[model samples]
Target: MNNAGRDTRQSTRFMLLYALAAAGGATAYVPFLTVLLPVRVADLAGAQDIAWLAYVAFFGAIASSLSNIGFGWLSDITGNRRGWIACGMVLSCALLLCVTQVQDLTGLIAVIVVWQLCLNMMLAPLTAWAGDCVPDRQKGLLGGLLSFSPALGALAGVVVTHPGMASDDVRLMLVAAMVVGCVSPVLIMGAPRRFPELNQPSAIDQTPRKARDWAALTPAIRMWIARLLMQISEAALFAYLYFWFRSISPGFGDNDVARVFGLVLLVSVPFSLLCGRWVDRHNRPNLPLVVGAALSAVGLLTMAAAQDLVLAIAGYVLFGIASAIFLALHSAQTLRVLPRPEHRGRDLGIFNLTNTVPSLIMPGLTLAMVPLFGFSGLFVLLTALAVVAGLLLVALPRPK
Candidate 1:
């Protein structure tokens, strides 16, 4: 390639990076719009019963788990991600707006269910788009860029919900949604659709099942499963971190939660980006995945051991850093092993179940664990899970 052509290519890749980051940024608002709102939903729904939230969470998990494959399959056949992205955003935002008007459990449940479905529809295709263009070598960088978006979105959520700005919070969320809606078109217009070769099972394949088939578990698929397990450990903490903080240290408030989560994200962003750079430079993505998961396990254990809020915050920040590193590299590695590149949207959707399935199960598991294992026991269990996941990653054959 000519120097100018090479420079343009480099520029295009960087733009793609920022676009991915912005898409990640958009993902941040979901917690506020969905999971975080249930507190309000309890009051609005007149049930004041968290069980309803759990029910919604359970169903949402199912929808999220299924939508990945459903939309991914569609994206694979269509070869156009932008349309799905736009439709998902618009439908989800409308649902968010609709949910704000709900005033009962039935209404809340119905709206949330639909909203979750649409959000997943958007996310499945959007996430698959990441693997579509980027090669395995740059997956870590892409993962880092994708990882930071939630932090940015979290900040946006905080800004929109300033104390006494209740009237405007919904509006701000809508604005966030609108900003995300714009991302797909801009990405479509700018990024070149260079269709890379797909990794397909042979036409005359004698194997009983395709590796991507739900039943088949290749080394790479096993690695992805490990990544999913790690995410579940993280989700277990996420589902209950606020409740635990409140139970253990009620003096801390929402701002405290946001601040702690924000600090964690802040620490994580640099570490994640650096980990990605290290992976690209040295080709050692798995090492970081292993180390980061271990660190996170330690952090979780520390959180359980903490006697004061400061210690807990420290633990949270450490966990955040470790989780971020693992997520960035683990995702890149998973992208490398997908059974079908043409079906990235489909395969990634299925893989994302690892991420979403936990969200569904973790909350109930946390509640159940606390009664039996208590918080410390929960942490210990989480630590063990993380270790197992890390070891599984180590066991996977190094990708060529």
Candidate 2:
């Protein structure tokens, strides 16, 4: 009983530290990628800014996808998650500083590709380390804790881009420093001995991961598809939200949309935390995802049905809240459905595809949908996708 009590405390502390690290990881890239990357491209590319931004995004996504898988497999083979993360952080920060020195677009792309490779070297393993440490019973709360990452990341962007301080090198320096600060504490501390040999760095998992072992992931596969669908919508809104709001009210400016966007994400924090606790307590994990998707579908529908500014904003608020929770909770639940502990890092890197693929798919999807049927048409299509995501989760077999 005494041992059990100690273990519980250790696990709780681990979750908190892990959550901080997750937020730090987001801080590393979110500000730079979202705000600074385009600014850099525009400064270098001159009049071809749009073309340059597209190329950078395309190459960056490809690099992010491939490197996440490669580095994750490396970590798995080496049987050390933390070591790789530390090395990756240092190298990526060095590369991040190098980002300030690039004078041409070609050089910028080259640097970004390498930086992305090193960045995922940290991210992929950091993600899998949580799976190694946290048990299924706590994944819901773990995910809830992780829900803070993106919000803080957005806030970090605001911080690095403050009007008073305005040097590209200085901004990059702040980002690199923030990454080190947020990720260092967890790296210094040791992993908890909460699970069976999970924390041990002994040997590679070289046994062939067979087809039969893969069969156990039917639910995970459903989750994969559902998450992809939800992300498609989220990515679309992420890309075109400003335009959509501007369409409703031509008076809407970038600052207006940015403020609204950040606020909506901030609001999701309490909802996700509360829902995460509820999910852990009830163990009906799929239900919340289903409900969140359905509500998001309604939100999209509301976007279509009410094109007026007030109703559109309300619709977006609902969609943003629901989508945020679904994404957060689904991330934790994905760990529960993974087949083998040994391959957790690699499989998670595969899951990381869902994050990057949308950028690829949504741009083409939005262009195809919006030109034909207008923003209303795109909203309706997104509504359909969100519904399908919900139904997929509904089909998942429940716990006995």
Candidate 3:
């Protein structure tokens, strides 16, 4: 094979490793946040104080948002990605293990805040590192690979929380170990430094241009908005998913929910991979993204209309698959739309707001909506949000 082919192969391998590492990092905390933390909080604060789960989520979201932006900017300024990831992973692992020791609400909150910061330190830079290295054409494949992260996260939750697990501390330790093990490949191999076309000037160079230059950014901005709206729906559901399941079927347990979630994610993986490949081959990401959003809306509406456990699970599956496709495709497309290569890290950080901000708002949104209208109302709102997200994508100008 030619040099270009070899580089492409190598880059593909690197991105695969990076994607897995990202998944590992996510596994460490996502389950903890979505599944374990709520249970732990309820256990410590009393089942009646379940509202504290929202507070903890809010705190963690704020910390993660700020830290993600800060660390992304710092990586750009220092011109280093690997070091930040390594350092952050180490600190995150140590802190995660410490979480099992927290005995009170205040202590738990403190640990979550710090843990969020540490996790973002790794995540932000890791995302930036992708823009720094991956060629635009391959972003779709990368995004497809990224879909595995959430699946792995859900599976990790199942593993750690399984009834046969040793102890909470030991479970925590296992999560920490997974984080280290997953990230070790990227760190050990070192960040890829030679993508010949990796940061070449596109139409939207840092230099000033006319209205058209600004217009060029609209696609990325639209995708950002789309992801934000869809994520709001996702965050609302994820935060309350456990409770929702319990309310729907009091007989079901955490393991049952995890199994359903994991199955949905696993089903999404191959579909996401195929969607990514289609996006890459066709150079038409918008169609898939918009379709995914629409699918999510359908899923939300399904959930809103469901009156039984089987129906609820079906709705979740639809929503989960749609979310997986949209997120993976949108992520792959992000690298293509960034306006400034010189500040790719910072720009990507800004884009990440779409991810973190939803978490911040979802808690408040859920509390306000659920009390007034119940889960049905919440799902209806989410359905509308998903539809709007798709519409925004439709508004974007077609790629040149």
Best by TM-score: 3
Rank order by lDDT, top first? 3, 2, 1
lDDT of 2 at 384: 95
CA lDDT for candidate 1: 0.68
**Candidate 2 residues 1-400, lDDT tens each?**
9988667543666788888889889888877776677668768987676557656767887899899988888898998889999999999999999987999899999998899999999999999988888877777898788888877776777777766665889999998999898899899975665587554433435555565546577888899999999988887776567567877898875446656666777788889999999988888888999999999999999998876899999999999889989999999989888777788888889998988787777766766777698888888999999999999999888765
lDDT of 3 by residue, 168-252 (tens): 7887888888888899898887557477566655544565577666676777778788889999988887788889989889988
* Model 1 Cα lDDT, one tens digit per residue, 113-147: 77777877677777776666666657777667666
Task: Using lDDT, give the best candidate's number.
Answer: 3
Give the root-mean-square deviation of each candidate in angstroms: 3.3, 3.6, 2.0
* TM-score of each model, in listed order: 0.88, 0.88, 0.95
lDDT over C-alpha atoms for residue 98 of model 1: 66
As a whole number from 0 to 100, the lDDT of residue 3 in candidate 1 is 77
lDDT minimum window of 10 residues, candidate 3? 199-208
Q: What is the lDDT of every predicted structure here?
A: 0.68, 0.83, 0.84
Report, for all candidates in order, the number of backbone clashes: 3, 0, 0
lDDT value, residue 211 of candidate 3: 68
Clashes of 3: 0
